[model samples]
Target: MSTSFWILCHDLKGGGVIRKSGSIIKSIRQHTDAWINVHKLIPRDEERITEISNTRQRMDYYEKAISLREAEDVASLQEKLGRTLSKAEISRIGVSKLRLFLKELLRKRYMDSVPLIIPLLEKEYNNTTRKLNEINRELSTLDEVKLKEKGRAFHDLF
Candidate 1:
């Protein structure tokens, strides 16, 4: 079975699902302490993000995808997806949007608002780290099993 992975830069808010591209995932791996999630978007199919070129591109790809609304026509879609934008562009869009969202939510001025945000961020970081470690362990085990099976096969043949 063929497998694919996407490296994404997730935030305190929900993460953007990155479209797996060339070395983008590798770039992400080089920078950022981001945690990865293995998703089975389809039954019996799994995906992961291995590397990203840099933190900037990783952030940009994520922002563009998130900011992309439902394009009404092929022209609009092409315009949006056509040329690549710089890392700065991506970071600007993402940060601006997130700020706007937070501003709106904060406008409510609820009593528990500040307290709520802190715990949520902490929880997200904790969860992401835990998941990353778990995935590494699982992958290591799988590799060991494969190696053992290969050794057994060789012995049987001899």
Candidate 2:
């Protein structure tokens, strides 16, 4: 018999189904069960995966901005000092300390560039830091328990 016939029989009340067609009925029951289990859950899972991807991308951009700012600071310092300053030295001195030192140096010796460079660098650094903190808060709020329960792997989504 066609699946539609079985479906019609299933819809009718008191439709006496035969034992010979038990396998077909069971197959239909399994299909319905799978459809019900997966239908509503997948969209929610995909949404979360998208959220995770977007959050990570934002974090990466901020982190890269921070790194680029550090490199630019080091380059500027090296240019003014007329000596090589390794990135490792800047890291060892620490970012805030280095920025403070650079600001002071620029103010004392190269006073003209102070207005143009210091304010913009400070603003960019502060904005990036604040955005990174906001991204962290967003990450903390995101829950992956539902995806885990659904047997969805993060690796597969990436």
Candidate 3:
């Protein structure tokens, strides 16, 4: 890979966080040979993969999920409601983002308990990180897609 391509691919954040996933896909399809193969890459042991069985089964479930989503008329209602969902659900949500959000939230909620003079994450850093870690671990293995669907996109995370 070229230097620019390598840098973009290895952002080292564990996953991509660009604002426009669709745009990235379009760019790669138009300009590069770096298509992703989820089946080839995803580790099978990490989670359950329901046996789709056949096209009828796949189509039936997909249509059902789509209809349910239409009934709810919300972007991610299907995922939140435990209906069939797509990979965008997982990619848009991530462990690191959740941890960061929780960190800022705790600081905001307990501002008086935290020092104002010192930089954030400087004073009582260990304590805060410890609590966040506990929270993260406790919340681990949550349906990442569903939790992400619940998060607000009112402001761009990019």
Per-prediction CA RMSD (Å): 21.7, 31.9, 26.5
- Full ranking by TM-score: 2, 1, 3
Where does candidate 3 stray beyond 4 Å?
1-77, 80-92, 114-158
For model 2, residues 15-114, the per-residue Cα lDDT tens digits are 2432344554455456653111111222212211111121234545655887888778778888999999776677644363554466567668777777
Query: What's the CA error at residue 148 for candidate 3, in Å?
Result: 78
What is the TM-score of each predicted model, taking all chains together? Answer: 0.23, 0.26, 0.17
- In candidate 1, stretches whose alpha carbon ends up further than 4 angstroms from where it belongs are 1-112, 144-158
For residues 1-158, what per-residue lDDT tens digits would candidate 3 score against the true structure?
Answer: 11122122222331342225555545554665443221212332222212212123444465587666554543465656777556665433444235445756776878866566466557579789889999999788688777676675533564
The lDDT of each candidate is 0.52, 0.52, 0.48
Candidate 2, superposed: residue stretches over 4 Å from native: 1-109, 147-158
Of 1 and 2, the candidate ahead on TM-score is 2
Which window of 10 residues has the lowest lDDT sum in candidate 1? 39-48
